[model samples]
Target: MSTIIEQNQSNIITDNGLFPSNEVMLDLKNLKKVYPTPKGDYVVLEDLNLQIRKEEFVTIIGHSGCGKTTMLSMIAGLNPISGGRISVLGKQIKGPGPDRGVIFQAPSLMPWMTALQNVLLGVNQVFPHATKAQRNDIAKYYLQKVGLEDAFNKRASDLSQGMQQRVGIARAFAIKPKVLLLDEPFGMLDSLTRGELQDILIEIWNKEKITAVMITHDVDEAIFLADRVVMMTSGPKAKIGDILDIEFERPRTRKSVLEHDDYYKYRKHLIDFLEH
Candidate 1:
């Protein structure tokens, strides 16, 4: 991983050597978000700007309450922005739509629904124009893709936490969203389960070719999954403190990414700001 300082170096390994702001897909310009608090205005973001290109996995690493999740909520149109603008494919995003899919920290599945039915909810809502057969096929395909084939008939309440998250991933993918937003999707799982799910998510991302932005506190997970690791500063109002380019080859394995020359350097860099 290449840190903020390393980005200044001309020879940094970028995709076809493209610069940061040149090939943009989703762009945020001078975004500022403030929340109403008893203590007055609590600003989360100030003059924050970012540009994400097509089909890139961008992972954001920050301390708690650094406003990383706030930024994602704004981008997903789940929350209103206090100022500035966010554009998706050059169009203003004013509200939540099927084009942006979010996998939040918790599974948030309906207790009364089965795993298969929960996934079908997204299919029903997003692909309302399609036939019943098509919706069923899509939902089934996504569930199987996430390794939940056997659990398809199980109720959400009956599944384990890991199993529930798998269902959540399948459901999010069922919509065929243009962008995928993940908020600590693997944080709740055990080490072995976490690795397995990470692999599953990587496979899904490769097959779908969807643009993904994830907010994670896990340094290892950020480096393992993302094309670039974006670090935020400590906040009342946070800005981009660092941007790290991951130089590991495609289809990155845990051992390979860890063995890379700059891996420890990157880890050390991120550890510094974790104090906040």
Candidate 2:
């Protein structure tokens, strides 16, 4: 049995057996991933556990092949878990659901679809009850929010890399997902474009207040966007190495974060973890 308590305007669900509190949006318990190879079973992640609170933004950082994407895909229900369980709001994840939205390394938009059409594809699915005009407005609003107002009718194939990603961001957010899973969404963009998109992402996240988990190899990016930076140990059996909480106040800007006294300290810690 589970208990629901109202605390400080937040619903905290507690089950003496499993869930600790309702404030927890995503919970991963004793998670494991194993690949069966002819040589033997290759374990990628073992005994991984994590909890993300509602509306919190967490970033995962690790060297290449540390199983960051594997963990994220499990949470998204895109991949099968060999052991343990993943739950969102106390519901065990079995497969991909609309409750989780994903932005991959590539935008992954339908090239033949116009930006508006691509976004509408998701908006329509999520808001099936919304009237035609209402759904159109919802899609347009998010597109404009991501600075894609002028690119609304442009085909995805015709858009620049940065522009396509903007559409991806807009599409993911427009669905009003409970969790936004990002797998190096900006990895392929130019530095300037990446910075611009980061700002856009943060601004929208601030307004939307969605719980987010992102994977980044860039320490600065991990620090800039995360409320907590989760470090992973190097793989064949990668697990959480450490977690660093970013204490800077939100509605944050790159300029403000960079100038903060703890900025370099946080950067050094993340870099040191990756290097050593």
Candidate 3:
């Protein structure tokens, strides 16, 4: 159902007309990041390049300080680039915009606001021209999709950590962003909760088909959720070390993926990279 086209240092995964089209949605060229300190300039990333195609899910993995989060922040326009450019659909990113929705490790919701109200915050910004009823519907729709139908009216402070994160997921998608940026969105939860959230995320992504980029350290999680697993070398000048194409069929379940012949092969390869 998908084809892997190997590029210079990256792999492009394309479906056979399942998505709208096989086009580059996110492009990073000669990307660099630096922090000027009194001692000297500290470089975080240099000459990092990657292209994420439409409807593709790419996960980045690396050792602790490999600039994975830095790169992701640049794409989200939350951080400034020291050099090069990152573009979405041919347009260069200047700053944070509605087209890209970011979900960080923390839910970062306002304690005073209810779950539905938190979702409405972004919906209101993105759909200002739409009627209030339409915006409310959009917010409610995503909340239900994330299995927060009963918690819609609950204040964020009153909800469990997992429930708060569900609200975060709902808020990010409610904006209908063209690209979703996830920085260990489930890192704070228990293994069971994390797995449940992963399934929920993939289910939503299957239907939305939004281009996604995630930063994760979990090897199995990276393989299960990604079309391509990007491995980054150790920092303080991290660059992509290698890219692995995951050829698993879509509508993937944990059991099906784990049972696949190549699953452990992929796992071993990732483990080898991380250990070495």
lDDT of 2 by residue, 77-117 (tens): 99999998899988898799889999989999999999999
Q: What clash count goes with each model?
A: 0, 1, 0
Clash pairs, model 2 backbone: 13-22
Pairs that collide in candidate 1 are none
* Cα lDDT of model 1 by residue, 73-161, tens digit: 89999999999898877677989888999998888889699998999898999988999989889999999999988888899999988
What TM-score against the true fold does each predicted structure earn?
0.89, 0.94, 0.93
- Give the poorly placed runs of model 2, Cα more than 4 Å off: 1-20
C-alpha lDDT (0 to 100) for residue 28 of candidate 3: 87
TM-score of 1: 0.89
Could you tell me the lDDT of residue 72 within candidate 1?
95
Model-by-model lDDT, in order? 0.86, 0.92, 0.90
Question: Which candidate wins on TM-score?
Answer: 2
Rate residue 70 of model 3 by lDDT: 94
What lDDT tens digits, residue by residue, belong to model 3 across residues 1-276?
A: 233343332433333222222377888888999999999999999998888888899999999889999999999999999999998986889999989999989999999999999999999999999999999999999999999989889999999998899899889988989899999999899999999999999999888988999999899899999999999999998998989999999989989999999999999988899999
Which window of 10 residues has the lowest lDDT sum in candidate 3?
Answer: 13-22
Error of 1 at 90 (Å): 1.0
